[model samples]
Target: MSDTNENKLYGLVVEFGDSNALVKAAERVRDSGYTHTDAHAPFPVHGLTEALGIRRTILPWIVLGGGLTGCIGGFMLQYWVSVSAYPLNVGGRPLNSWPSFIPVAFECTILLAGLSAMIGMIALNGLPRPHHPVFNAPNFERASGNGFFLVVEADDPQFDLQSTRALLDDLGGAAVSEVYDD
Candidate 1:
């Protein structure tokens, strides 16, 4: 890899077998004055978020905003088409009748919220570009099966190459590897 590619990975990889072990390791790493750490597991591990001190995601807020925008847009479109741009008299009904607009507004809200959730999740996860340094590690294919992995990023102020390795070793990690950015 070129120098530019080498600058991407900045961490240490600690391999584990079980969720319990991974959670314990995460807690240890978090308490070790390290802030940039991530964990990978074959399945969602309960309490893992709490262990990593991860805050609630902002996707809900994004969805809410999108839903609100959709509602307003739908209402405005119906209002403009029925009340302002072209008003039609049907069964002596008045223009700007809100009851008839509810269905469109509701559908738009659902559509926008769903779209926002999908897009927000992808955006927040930094998707599309596929390469990851963890893939370079041997036997990492098992990560999607039964393996559990924890990575403590080197950018953390407390991360020292030697000390971090030593810490992982002391934490009963099955294997520890230095992750390069490039």
Candidate 2:
């Protein structure tokens, strides 16, 4: 309990043998009211999200707003330039040619939506995070291979070192360890 970063507590990590164990542990953690818990597995584990109780993200709404803005802005830019800024009537065709603007507007909609999705996803996920305390967990690299792990962050209100460790130990996990910020 020295005033140093190395001694800073990050969380408790537990390794499960398989996806089923991981999912069940997540459910138990959620039911026990541990808000800052996370689970990791080598591959996509079905029912993990439901067990974690993670709510849907609002990124789709953000992307939709971007697309709509792009569409309207693209079409308006063309309309203003062609009809008001410098009207050019050629061969009895109206200066305000709406049909010709469709392609560009459609492209803008797609472009903005794609950009929004990419940027929003990255920003929302807290990207560019080169380091995390979970990486300090024992055998954590196996998370991408054969590991299924659960992490209960120390910042959670219900996270007591001894009790959390005991809870994980009692969950039939293969191993349990502490994670440090250093």
Candidate 3:
């Protein structure tokens, strides 16, 4: 490919008539050892993630870390205020009482975990992305409504425009189009 054409190249997009075709195409692409591929559908299609060979996300770990930090911080804050900062004696109760810290600790843990999950998901997804290169392809607007789509990025080592288009066509893609860079 010429440098100018290569620069204009974004990827190849394959359109499927339904969820079954989308899943089958994804599986074929995965089995062909194409890693840099994505599938989109109007609704959740069973087994699509596995078909695409998508791995587990680290968002859970992020949330767990956030929760742990919140739990520890909450307990320490209470301890500092009651025992060291103020040292108030309430009804002959000990200043460093452990039971009184449970409620605040629990709330802090939940709050931090939930926030971390939302933020982590958005960050991982590269959200606030008003546009993507795939949107340049014809009929891409149907992806969110009735169409199922599979995209193979140009950066994939196995990608060759002619061969990739042929492969998609062979895999029952009704319409295949070249995606362009934004």
Q: Which candidate is the best by TM-score?
A: 3
TM-score of each: 0.93, 0.92, 0.94
Pick out the ten consecutive residues of candidate 2 with the lowest summed lDDT: 1-10
- In order, candidate lDDTs are 0.86, 0.90, 0.89
**Per-residue accuracy of model 3 over 29-55 as CA lDDT, tens digit each:** 999899999987889899999999999
Candidate 1: where are CA atoms >4 Å away?
1-9
Off by over 4 Å in 3: 1-7
lDDT score for residue 69 of model 2: 90
- How far in Å is the alpha carbon of 173 misplaced in model 3? 2.1
Q: Model 2 segments beyond 4 Å from truth?
A: 1-5
Clashing pairs in 1: 5-182, 6-181, 6-182, 7-182, 8-181, 9-181
Worst 10 residues of 1 by lDDT: 1-10
Clashing pairs in 3: none
Total clashes for model 3: 0
| Better structure of 1 and 3 per lDDT | 3
